[model samples]
Target chain A: MAEHEKITMAQAFNQALRDAMTADESVLMFGEDVGALGGVFRVTDGLTAEFGGARCFDTPLAESGIMGFAVGLAMNGMRPVVEMQFDAFAYPAFEQIVSHVAKMRNRTRGALSMPITIRIPYAGGIGGVEHHCDSSEAYYAHTPGLTVVAPATVADAYTLMREAIASPDPVVVLEPKKLYWSKDEVDLDEVQPGIGRAVVRREGTDATLIAYGTSVPIALEAADAAAAEGRSLQVVDVRSIVPFDDETVCAAVRSTGRAVVVAEAPGFASVSSEIVARVTERCFHHLAAPVRRVTGFDIPYPPPKLEHLHLPSVDRVLDAVDTLQWDDV
Target chain B: MPSHDFLPSEQPVQLLDQDGRRVEDPKRAFPSDEDLLRAHEALVVGRRINEQAYALVRQGRLAVYPSSYGQEACEVAAALVLDDQDWLFPTYRDVVSIIGRGVDPVETLTLLKGDWHCGYDPTEHRVAPQTTPLATQLIHAVGVAHAATLRGEDTVVMAMCGDGATSEGDFHEALNFAAVFKAPVVFFVQNNEYAISVPLARQTVAPSLAHKAVGYGMPGERVDGNDVAALLSVLGDAVHAARSGAGPSLVEAHTYRMQAHTNADDATRYRQDDEVAAWQGRDPLLRSKAYLTGRELLTDERTAEIAAKAEAVATVMRDGLMQDVEPVPGDLFEHVHATPTPQLREQAAFLADELSREKVS
Candidate 1:
């Protein structure tokens, strides 16, 4: 086993890019400010100096062009890890992402596979401006051929990014921008679980709290609060969103017979709603009450001053858990 | 240097006039007899493909067909200007170009027939799928060429689009990226007058589509798209320039859309018959045939052989398209990823059970 080092999620992401580029000659990194400026968040800091300009370079500041060319590079057998500077900034490239990047493999009938990884720093809580803090996972998850994953922990951040880069199909890694500074001791060389599998961060019996990305930590914090109040809660981190881990999630829901999905995105037609529906259908007979969801309101992302009220917090999650009908059965 | 150095000529480059007379150029040399004959044969075959695809659309075999009827010169030239290892990124209207690259005629119509997005292996033919969305494929070409350049490979990419696509933001970005990175790519815009009813004037107010390239710091050229000889000469030069790593070049082929945008569209609703008739007089195949015969290179026997080869291709396309392709219900769950997810597996099994139940009923 390798020595474990305490590091931030941002550092872990940088290490993952360095390790992947070191291991494979085809892996490339490029985006608007990803090269010289090392990205706005500095998640890609020092990559250009290490990999040289040929492998890590900046583009012409066009989002659609960045994604469109990444598709081309992937077609030519290069593993391109592109960065969308912010969540809302990715809208310009949505057509390319939805039309080409997501459907290229299926469109080619397996003849061509896009081994492209798009890293988006998403979700609110860091008091950034409006566009900087959007939870846009539902858009990517709704697309069939794409693999959407969000890592909340430092360890999963490193391992999941490496996994996304190595996958044959395109993967959208929604890095929690608010959690970029969150740190933990992680084994850099340790192999974690692959994509499409959820991890149970904390196990309990009273109810299950399902969350991912920015919501995972909030759910865990709510679980801790619930434990002090004489109610045990299980936290299921839905690491993968597209090829959703129904086995682990449903098993957790069935065991607890209650679930409350938490997310920072609006609840209307969102991933949280999907999780609630899936839990209802699979754990209907075992449930003590209907599944509930605590999410951001159905409105545009609020300004930083009002973001705390807009984002799902520990109190919001526990309040939803309180509605899971603890006294019904 | 002044912008005029990058601007296209007052008139499009024409090697052979519409009357089949050779136009002398001090800076450019005409193609050889062999290349002319080859291009003429491809023009004939490409015209037959358009005609056959029209018939297929009428027969309800193909869902829709976007005929490259008047643009055969540009299509054929775009395909012939590439090496076997070079990549060709084509649009939906460039089936003739795909055929010129030797893709199976039947496989080329797979997307139109609604059987699959692309039937042939892209790697096998070095052709990207015939992109339906406008101007998106151009950036892909830049990416491929950039990759090749990075790896020290001598691969050039030819990206095809129409006059209207030049107005897209992607077009601007693609040209800028290709020039900035010095990626070996040729932006081939077949200025075929309209994009499904929208004319060039509505699309852009530029002096000419090719002149727009100068803003991106790359040389741009315009050619008489209906003159096969000129198309071959100009596109050939652009491809060679890209292959030699002189960076990207934009070539705008001035032509007309002789037919409606597709079989579903009504050309009469937008343009007058006189306009379409005027372009017919400058038909690519007619001009190519006259030039070839004038050069003593196209004899009756060779013409008949070429026509027969075209008929064989049409026959193959008809036979292949007429066959009913059964959709495999289970295939819906395949290829979404390298490995099927547990949810997909459960859904596949549920679908299978439903199908078996329907059969038992």
Candidate 2:
């Protein structure tokens, strides 16, 4: 076992990829700028030099070709972790991810399985231009044959990458760019389980704040603020977005009776919206107030100054929590 | 990344005379007469299936169908190049190719019948669904070839497309990828002169479409698509080269569409009657009959027997089309996703309710 040391979220991702590559010869990485440049966010730093081009390299600037070739490579018994430079830039390859990568096994009646990892640097906190700051995880989560996940901290980043690589299905791992520089203690040597399960970050009795990716930190901050204000707030980190730790969500919402869903994606028809709808239906009898969502506004991710307004902040989460009918008793 | 070395130049290969006589060429040696006779029998079956499909369109059984009325020779010839284990990626016009490859005619109609997906299993038949999105399947075929090579399998992927598909980005990418990786694939471009409405001259600036293969570092050749013997020889050579690890090859089959593109297309608007008459004189089936008569292989009674068998096959297919088939609405949701998501399940349930209400009304 390795000693736990605080490291940035980007470094954790880099270490996770390195650890996984060392353990399994099947793990390979490829994307534009992932080679000598260490990836745009440096999540894949030193990988190309360590593993050589056969195991890690840069592909043509064609997104569809990269994903389509990864599908071929995975079908041929190689686990390829593809980097989609930014979340918004992954649209060109969306068809491949949706049509072929997700559907290959089902189409072939289990003859083929796509154990590919698609790493996306997503969310809108970096002030990166329009194409770089989109939270497109909901579009992928909506697609079947794919598992969607996001890690809000260093420890989860390390564990989730390894878990996603080992799964027998395609996985889309979105790394919130804003949290990439944030540091936390993580055990580098410990192997992690599959990323299909969610984690309860904080315990409380009054209400539950469910969030994933960038919003996890906001929910944590909001929970602390609520605790100080004499309100009990249970915070749940929905690490897996697609298979959606529905069991955890249902249990948390039922116990608390009040829920606030949070996400970096827009509130209109976003992943958070889906969560609220499902929770409302399943936990309808256990409700104290209509489920409120603190999320990005229904507009294109605006400029840097406006992005802070668009994204869900701790203040927004608290505001949503305050709307609950606590005085009804 | 040498500029000139990027693509290999193309050379067209033709072994049959306009009159359908096989030329004496060692490079174009074909199978024995018994093999050709078997192929001829298959061609008859394919023609019957095609005729039935054409009539189905008229009877409102199918949404649309592009008939290969006079291009049966090209379809059958391309399909005959491979064993059942080999793969084929065909376009929408390759109806005869599908039938020649042993697919049931009824299953082929499943696509135009608005059956959500391709009619047959690609892995089971090694024939991908007929690609309606132009040359996208070209790249997929190359990917399959790459997979086969990595697995150390000696299989050839035959990807068929039209002259118009050459204009697509997918075709360019597929050619480049295949050449760079030395993927075991053959690109069969059926140059049917017109791409719906645009003529070949308007499609490319090169003297011959086969010459475009030079850009991809592959051997490109031309063949008379209307001549079954020529098409078989050319495609067979390409397939052999691919299977033997010689790398990719492109075969440009010079053919012409005799019928309207579909029931909806009117070729008379762009093409003159004189042009159509000239090609009609060189009818591939008639030329085959002439050659068979010259070889003392076709008797009046044998010809009548072949015609009668073709008619019977057509009758069977037509009868099948007439029978009422109330398509189950539930089937639409079954294959949309391998395992339907919770959202998809909800959508399916919702649609089912709506459909049931309509039924009651």
Candidate 3:
């Protein structure tokens, strides 16, 4: 047994990379500036020096090439974990990912598999503009051959990454940039609750508030704010978007008889819409009112000064929760 | 460390001239009678299978087939140069190469038959499935080659694409990595002049596709794609260079697409019959047969025996493909991930219930 270690979300992620590399010799990590500079956010600091360049190296600044390279390596039995540096910056690479990475294993009828995990820091509130701050998880979630997961808590950052790397399907783990500095106690060696399921952050009965990645904290705070007003709220962090925990989400929505789905992406076509659809379909009879959504506007991610209106703020989440209508049909 | 041995000539190479005569070059390496005969037979069988597949597509027995009718020399020579330790990365227009690379006809054709993505086990033959999206698989070849180098395995990888595929960004990326890493791999671009209707003039403005490699700091060579013996020698040299870690080489095999890109495409829309006739005059099979006859391997009796063998293989392929394939009930529920998600499991169970008549669609 190993001793417990207090860590930040970023630190936990760093440890997760180290742990995965240590666990499997075939696990290779590479991306632009990931080696000598330890990643743009310093999440991979000391990995190159520790793991050596063979395991942890930097690639030329070409996302498409990086992903295609990973595709080949995975087919040949190496598990590659590539960092996209930022969320929107990963868009170019997703072309190779969608056309090849996602479909390769299925195309080969399981004779070949891509266990590559693409790690990207996503969402706004870090004050970075444009490509650095936009949330792009929905694109990956919509692709059939991909598994999408995000960690809201420090502990999940470690466990979900292990789970993502261990997954046979190609996975993209969207890490929230704003939550990077958020700290919590985590025992590196302890086996806590595993990943790929929704986690109830704070439980209550009046309504269920669902969110993931950067919105989980906002949902939790909203739950607290609603609790002060005597409106009990259940906060659920929806972790895996593709293989969403429909059972957990539906069960919480059914028990509470009302729901609010939240995300930092546009609501028209997003993880939030899918969650609302599933919760509405499964919890139709138990619902007290229409399921509400607190999401980013359909506009392109704006400058940081106006991001408060675009991001799912605590007030925005509570606003959605407040309009449950609670009237009998 | 810099580019080495790059010599892209203005004219395409032709070891066997137009009149079915050998063009003697004192400096070039040549093959033995056995290698030439093997190349000839591979071309013969590959064309027979290709012709059968074309007929099958027309008869509604096949979904699609990108014919390699006029490019058999490129197909045969590319495979003949590789040992069992090497990997062959090919494109969808490469059924001939697949057969030449030793993949079973039925297994290789299953994907084109609309039955599966790829029915054969790739690891068994070291041949990646035919990539349909242009030069996407080029990097995969380099990646595998790089991995092999890291593991100290002296395995070479041969990646084949068309003239149009060289226009793709993935092609450049593959060349860059192969040269930077000095991976043991060969980029065999069969310049068949057209890509699904777009002509070569529109495909690239470059003088030749082989010249694309010199910019990536690797040797690039051009070969006569229809001349099996010349293609065999050129690809053989490139394969040897790669296997010995001399770095990647690009060989542009100049040829012509004698048929429509696929059953869905009409070659008449973009090409002329006279041009096709001109290329048909230098058909890979005719030239190879002419060369094999000169070597006394294509004797009258042996020609009859080879035709009989090719016919038997075509019959087997037809029978294997014509048989009924039983798809498993839960085929859709399998292998989406190493472990299925809980929701996926629930959906699968729901599907099972529906199939059992307990629930309706």
Candidate 4:
């Protein structure tokens, strides 16, 4: 057994990049401030020093250029891991992401594969200003030919990052910025489940709370609160959003007969909405009540001071749980 | 060297004037007689391909065709400049250039025919899919060239765009990154006077498109785009410099889109006929033929042979495209990923059931 060490999600991510680069000579790391400055969040700290500048260097401040070239590099047989710095900042590269990075394989009829990983620091908890915090996973999740994953635990963060880099297709890693400093004891060598599989964070049978990325910990907290009130609320972390683990999610919903999808992104026509629709269609007979969604309001991310009012809170999840029609019980 | 050294000359480079008279360029040399003859033949074939594509669009065999009717010089030269190991990144209008790279003419029209996103294998042909979004492929070219440099390969990438594309932000970013990293990329801008209906004046206020490259600290050259001999010589020089590690260069080929943006566009809505007639006097094929005959490099027999070859290619394209394409419903689920998700599998099955039901009806 490998020794377990207490580390933050940021450290886990940094270690993952270092390990992937060390393992594959073709793996490269580049983006704005990813060099000696080690990314704005320092998730890429010490990588440039460990693997010379040629392997881990900083790119010019151009998001579209960074993504566009990453596609080219991937086409030429290099595994490139690019950092988007922040969630909102990735919008400049949206055309490249949707048009080329996401469609290159299908566009060429599988003649070319884009083995590129785009890491975006997403969601809001810390009182950072607007644009610094956004749950932009919905955009990536909606695009085809892209594998989107968000890891809530330290162990999953490391393992998922490694898997994302190793995948032959493009993967979008939505790292929770607010959880960067959250610490957990984890064995670095312990490989978690691969992408496209949901894991149950907390087991129960009364109702299921489905969440991902920054919302997983919040869902767990809400479940703990429910437990004190004699309710057995289950938590299912939907780590992968695109190739959604429909089997696991549907099974969980069927077992509980109720589901409340959770995320920081706005609920209207979002990944949360998609989840609710899928749960409704697949578990229509098993469902006890209408599937509910506890998500951010359908508005632009709020100012830092009022973000608490905009983001989904434990009270909101419990309130949604109450609406799931416990009258039958 | 100072950045000013990279500025384009006051006059665009020219080997043959519009009258097919040889103009002396102290810094540039004419291509060998053999290369010139080959380039002329390619120009002839490229123009024929454009004509046939127009006919296909009228016949409803193709959804639309962006004819590179008058830009044959830039199209053929860009393709002829690269070695077999090199790669060419082309735009939607660069089908002539794509075919000149030895890609099958029928496969080149696949996207326009609406049969597939791309009809041929990019890796096998060393040509990228015809990119529709302007200036995006430039960055891809830079990245590929940079990768080749890292792997210690002598591959140079020729990225083709237009005058209007140079106004895009990705264009500037690509040039800046290529120069900073010293990637082996040549950005060939075919300044065909119009991007759809928008004229060059509406695109940029810069003195010239090639002059924009000086800001990125790379050498820029402007060539007479209608003069195939000039395009071949100038692009050949740029490619050679990149292959030898002189870093990236930007070459702006001065030309005109003699045809409308596409068969769907009405040229009379944007410009006067006189403007088109003026450029017709500078036709690339006419100039190439005149120069070849003047230099005694072209014989009647050679011209007939070239014309026959062009006709054969056009016939093949017509025959291949006239055949109905078989659509596979299951192919939609394939190639989305190496392994389809459970959701994708379920969706695929549902689609299959629906298709079968329709068949019964």
Candidate 5:
């Protein structure tokens, strides 16, 4: 294996882009400010310089155009990666993303496959407020023809991106904006576990904590706090939201018989809601207590100063975990 | 505006006048008599299919059909101009165009019959699914054409939309993208005057829909939609320019909707019969046939033979549509993705078990 190096999630994402572009001549990147500015998060930094403007260039500030253009590019056998700038900024292009990009392959009866990846810096916690930070994983996850995923670690940031690019279906890669600078030691030559599979990042014997994207770190922090109290907890990171790794989640929840799901999106019709429902459905008999969810409020994302109150903080997650019954313990 | 003057005399381009008289433009050369006869034959078939599909919809054998009865010349010419390597992005109203492109009529009606997501396989044919949403395919066409250009494929893509669709943001985006990137694509807008109940003037205030293309920094031209020779020449030129890397162009064909939007609409509420009668004089099928007769390409026997061929094709399509299909309940989840999700998988299994138990009982 190659040398192990510590890098931030942003760096890992940039490396993945470089790797993808270098590997395939048909791969190209286009979006607002993705070119010379290297994206607002700088996740696409240095790509334009290395790949040349033809392969990596800026486009007019139109999200629908970017998405529609990407869909067409993929249909014509080119791999197109689009950066939607921010979670909320992508709403303008939601029609193209959902109606055309997501349904193209299915509508064409599998004759047309769009191998396109859309990268949106998502979720609140960076204090950007409004359109800058919003969690939209559920919208895409609910979509059938799309593959939705988010990276919680630097290694996953690099690996999941390449996997998304290589996949034959349209993939929505929700980059955890709050964790963009989160760093970890990653082996450059490690055998990738692949996308669409969940992993047990931490193990415990008590309640199982289910989360994806930004919630993974929060869930992990809550687990650590639980460990201090001598209440063991397991952390399950559902990297892929739509075709979620049901086996890992069901197994963990079934074993513990208690669970708490975490997310940054609203509690209403949210991804966290789906996780809790599934856990309850599969582990109903084994459950010691009802599964709880710690998520953003149903209201629109509040102002920056109020974001902490609106987001599911570690304390909020631990509170949900605390609700699990200890009678069996 | 870069010295390409196809919009002369403030009238749409036409090689043969509506009266079947020669009115050729010196600047634009005409196609050969052989080519004209071939176009006439294709238009005849296209118009016959249009008529038969309407009848099927009326008889309740088919659910809905968008007849391109008045715009057959533009529809047939659009398909005839493109090389098979090129792609076509058609809207719901462009079924006649798909049939003109050699896609099976029965397959093209599957979507209208509410049978499947798309009637024909996009890979098997160069035509994309006939999208119902206006102007959405325009952007998709630009995207696919741009990708082809990037890969150095000598292919052009065409997207068909109506006059009202020019008002959509996607149309603006498609033209602008094509112009900026020099994408090998063409935007074909058949200005048939109405979008369901909405008229063209209500959609845009531009002097002409072709003017919208000039604003996008691309060449735009208007053609007599009823004249097969004019449509063939204009569309062929645009496709050639795009394939040769002259970037994208917009061609607006002036035509009319001879039938209601679909079998459901009542056109009498919007326009008078006199207006419809005025357009009938410029019928695309009749004008082309008259032009062919003048050149002695269409004899009385040959006309009868063409009518028989068209009737046979329609009969086959009708019989195919009348056949009942065996439904697999699992197909509900099949095209949803390359692989169904865990939730869908569980539901599909549950359905399969319930059906098996019902059969056993």
Candidate 6:
């Protein structure tokens, strides 16, 4: 509890994993660079030194093998936490995720449950290559039997990680790559039950800006800027994608009369689009304008130089709020 | 000359003589009349279940039913060899094999019913779900075998797939993995002549599916799939080898598909009726019936009784189809995650509200 001093998101992640591994013998971790190099992102640093190779180790370079072996381990009463070096590298393992892990429990009529957590540092803004900076939470959300969650703050990251590790089903915790180095004060003394609820990062009366993962900070920044311009912008950081917090989102949108969903995933069939459609349906009578989405373009993740354009920035979110027809208000 | 190598080219075991006489192979353990009748009843049940499933598909009651019409003996033989504690990994067409292991017929139909993604649980009755993605379950079976061996449990994992699955990379990898690990799993390859529309020749260049096991350093045997006795004897030996910690063995059951791959698949485009007609002459059921009739164990009256009972069960299944469980609108979001994420919960609630409004209107 005394380690509550300011720490980077990576350090928080390392601590969360260490705490989980020490608390439960069933919690094992593995990935490619996880052993000797302590992960490419160093999110799993010092885990190997503390837990030894058996509890924390490196798998073959094959992502499918890592996931498949994890499925086997889970079936045999072991909770395995797998790390994908980057968001894009997790694609090869998608086969196991979709065909095996997600469906194993339901396929076996609830006889087998995959208590596997896949830690992926996702979304651009980290200056990574095309494959490394992918925001593919949409792919996992679309998959049945897999819980998709993205933590925006250091506290949420630390809390949600322990929850994900203890979950009886397969969970994908998408850690915001840009937030890895973002430092914040976190308390890891107590456990939390935030299974599927969005937190109100900022309360306001104007348009509600909905976002998750890396885009959460941009939405908060946009809200702050909106307040200076005399617009009371409410911001909601949607932590979970599968079982979304409709109550928080709808309540916020009902009061604001305007909603703008944001995400780093491509706009086409993106999680943001789903959010926009839901807001339009539930908050239509209170709407000052059609629900909008401030998200990445329909194209693939752009190069590092152009990622700023692809990702929804504070200015883009502000523009969405400003352009909304609020004359009725 | 029989040095126990038992190459596919060597003399294959036979029980029924060419003249339709009952002849017991001295080298094999003969099954009792009770066992043979049980096998016969299994074939009848398998045939009836396939017929009912196909009928349901035609009536718009099911999405697709891959009929296990022609491969009942292979399933029954393999299933009968397994003890209660042994595991069986079945492919899409193993409805009969699972049923032979005492799996409820209704539960087996869930795959066709499209109620579950994986369709069956392996832990219950020591049988895995019906694997639909070709030979993927073969590797899973190997892993299960490895797990059993690690626990020092004397159990055989019988993984069954079609001839076409032999060409899959997973099948080869599984075979190689099992051989290297010395996993106690029997690889049952039902070489039912064609894989979907692809003939065995196109599926594999290897002389025989069983012979492919030689490359992996495992024993292989080719058997007359129509001859249930031969299949039972071969699988029984393989199962024993696995249970005794003798490593893996591959059994290739040589048979033919009497029906189309599925109600959706048209065999006319790929195969000729002559091929079908030729295989029809070698109907496994007829040979078994001939053996039974010659020995005075069965009669036309008993056969009629079996058919009547099967018809009654089919009627019951058809009558039970009145319950149309239209999926609940928000249920799709239920199992995706143990707890739907905050975002999905919002969508589910939104949908619920939308439906409520529609109901009020």
Stretches off by above 4 angstroms in model 3 are A1-5, A327-329, B1-4, B350-361
Q: Write the per-residue lDDT of candidate 2 for residues B233-257, one digit (tens) a residue.
A: 7788789989888898888888888
Taking all chains together, each candidate's TM-score versus the true structure is: 0.98, 0.84, 0.96, 0.98, 0.96, 0.80
Report, in order, each candidate's fnat: 0.79, 0.12, 0.59, 0.78, 0.75, 0.27
Kindly list the per-residue Cα lDDT of model 5 for residues A1-329, writing each as its tens digit: 46677899999999999999999998899899988999888988999999999899998788888888987888788999999999888987888988888887777677888889999889878878567888888888887788999889898999999999888888899999989999888984576667778999899889898888888988999999989999899999999886788888999988888888988899999888888887888789989999998889998888899988998888998888877876665
DockQ of each: 0.84, 0.27, 0.67, 0.84, 0.74, 0.24
Which tens-of-lDDT digit does each residue in B293-334 have in candidate 5?
A: 887889999899888888887897789888877657887777
Q: Best candidate per lDDT, number?
A: 4
By lDDT, the candidates rank as 4, 1, 3, 5, 6, 2
Model 1 TM-score, all chains together? 0.98
lDDT of 6 by residue, B1-361 (tens): 2424635535555665433456677766666787777777777877787889888999888778888787788988989999987888888888778877877666677677776555446677888878787777776677566656656677788989999888876677678767876888899998888889988888877778888878878888888787777777778888998888789989988888889999899999999989898887677778777777788888888888878877765775576554576657775566555555555676899999999999999
Task: Compare candidates 3 and 4 on TM-score and give the better one.
Answer: 4
Model 4 agreement with the true structure over B66-85: per-residue lDDT tens digits: 99999999999999999999
Task: Give me the displacement of residue B356 in model 4, in angstroms.
Answer: 2.0
Candidates 1 and 2: which is better by TM-score?
1
The residue-level lDDT of candidate 5 at A317 comes to 83
TM-score of each model's chain B: 0.98, 0.92, 0.96, 0.99, 0.96, 0.91
- Name the TM-score of candidate 4: 0.98
TM-score of chain A of each: 0.98, 0.96, 0.97, 0.98, 0.97, 0.97
Interface RMSD of each: 0.8, 3.8, 1.2, 0.7, 1.2, 3.3
For model 3, the chain A TM-score is 0.97
Write the residue-wise lDDT of candidate 4 on A1-329 in tens digits: 56677999999999999999999999999999999999999999999899999999999999999999899999899999999999999999999999999998888879999999999999998898979888988888889889999999998999999999999999999999989999999988766888988999999999999999999999999999999999999999999897798889999999999999999899888999999988898899999899998999999999999999989899999999999888865
